[model samples]
Target: MSHVYQELNPGPFERKASMMITTNLSVLINDVLKGAATLLNQNWAITAAVNVFIIFFTVFLYLNTSTTSDQVTIRSASNNAFSGGNTTTLKEIVFHPNYGGLWKDDLALIKLATPANFSEGVKSISIAKSLPKQGTNAVVVGWGPKSYFSTTDGILREAVVPVMNYETCKQKYYPIFLFTDTSFCTAKDNVGPCPHDFGDPLVYKNKVIGIFSGSFDCGSTTYPAVYADVTQYNKWINKVIKS
Candidate 1:
């Protein structure tokens, strides 16, 4: 069976829409999985880094050829002011070997040059050990632009979205794009991450479960937002942090 899949780009900061028609589901699935295995085993050298305390944020932050480790900086605890928080430079970036073009396993760890001093506002978050169940309420946070027409105001924002059924989500993007086990979807509530919010964390019960990957219309009521399943990479994360 062949399916036609189409995605729309909200603006310059969002992914461009592409039309795809596929008949071989098994082959596509196999290729994506294999590609992840090969890519995850390799590491790219980018001088950019962020604080380990920030979790997998750098994974989504925009990076270009000119970006360097010392050039990357992270701030924590400031809710309204982007400049009003504890700041630190990044020392190293350890990306998930499995991260690939489809955004599966889209996560990374950063080593801060200095330890972050925890305070009433700045703190660390726990990674989810288990996958979140469908219908569970979760929070997604970011400082990105709220809409395509608006620019980022440097204020941190958050929204509550319910977890969508994995199988149902699979059907929604089937043939055009196959989501692996390392990915999940959240309900579209008209208010979620927009462009420049790729690396934001999806929080469930105070634990990080998902990393914002991508969405067609930001938070389209018709298309649910996709996320990288953080729980699926717990072992890899532990190994890298320990090593």
Candidate 2:
């Protein structure tokens, strides 16, 4: 049996443009990357020197006041799940606003009111710095509905999924607008994040490489589910943690 850390029932809410993407923050980093590229094009040494300065001087943080169906609560990994585990309150939640703050930039960094303590069943997982390659096997756990017709489960559930090619995901979600440059989709159906699974971490090699963003339907093999690529937001996360 896998360990379940957090559990949440976000309840019914709007789906369209509700998935988190982190486009707003990505734009800022893109600008930095662009500036670095320009300098590199001129002279690699100068660019490298400036890169270190920019990284050291940058302190990116933003406030979000929009309503969201997602919530973060830390709990224990006992068989009883959240029932016996301690619950942690959220101190702050950060996300980027883009595309009218509708769908793009869907990822959020949640700060707990109190720092967690590591114990026998409580530990922290690493977030991947590099993107997982296509066809990589990953695991996702959440307290979402099992299917479209099913109600949200109180306990956490997990599913194994394969990382699909970004190009293939773009093709499948073309008309619907998904799988952005900073997003990717998993393969198969009824085996990944379902409704209300937003913000769940997609684990690869015991590290989180993706975040549950959205899906057209629960357990749709064709569309699978979209997740915000964690590696794309590495800078954003690093800034938050360092601050």
Candidate 3:
């Protein structure tokens, strides 16, 4: 199992970036050639050459295959967010704001807070207040890495994006507005949530309220990063817990 986390929509480079393709191709060619040899009674040296070539190709392909990582980074490299002690905390919880925050639970402890307000998707965990923060402006921290397809497994990253008005976000991603309860959306920017930032925190007012879910593939000027509306998911979360 590869450890690198994926973020953002798979761009052209990412789409074509499958490492397994080479392996698959090699296996198929080997099988086909071997089968053909039985029918043709071909020379063994030639078949052996193909097998050697396949091994070389497989090695190269494996090296070249890249896994997409989280784009978030800490503003303060020295600060530790989780355990408290550092003067500045750097990490944040982020929602992919695109891919439905798929790996969220793995990265974050998805807790359903009691005294539940009518809000959706709200969960709470204790993190140090000392770490670097974006202030009232929401911040996200994720365990996914920083580069797109660079490592089979990567580290977590953190970033921040402004939350747009709900009406404005509705105009941006209407279908999501209709179906999924995203509290708000962000304008299109390199910072907009892309792929792997799942279970990242969407912090506002010193609270980790949002989880990176998605607006992964679907994007436009209006439709940028979309997230799971923690305020809206309150009831749903409670259901899971109470059950």
Each candidate's TM vs. the true structure? Answer: 0.69, 0.65, 0.40
lDDT of 2 by residue, 74-101 (tens): 3433322234444443355445434223
The number of the candidate with the highest TM-score is: 1
| Per-residue lDDT over 57-159 for candidate 1, one digit per residue giving the tens place of the 0 to 100 score | 3333444444444444444445432455444554566766655545555666655556555433344555778876788888766555657456655444556
For model 3, what is the error of residue 184's alpha carbon versus the real structure, in angstroms, after optimal superposition? 2.1
Model 3 per-residue lDDT tens digits across residues 1-243: 011123345532111112111111101121121100000001000011222233334434533444111111111111122212111111222222233323222111111112222132222232222222222345544433333343212223335456665566566654644324344554434443343333344555554455444453322244555544555444443343343
Better of 1 and 3 by lDDT: 1
How does residue 210 of candidate 2 score in lDDT? 72
RMSD of each: 13.1, 13.6, 20.4
* Whole-model lDDT values for every prediction: 0.50, 0.47, 0.31
Which one is best on lDDT?
A: 1
- The clash number for model 2 is 6
Output the better candidate (2/3) by TM-score.
2
Global CA lDDT computed for model 3: 0.31
Worst 10 residues of 2 by lDDT: 36-45
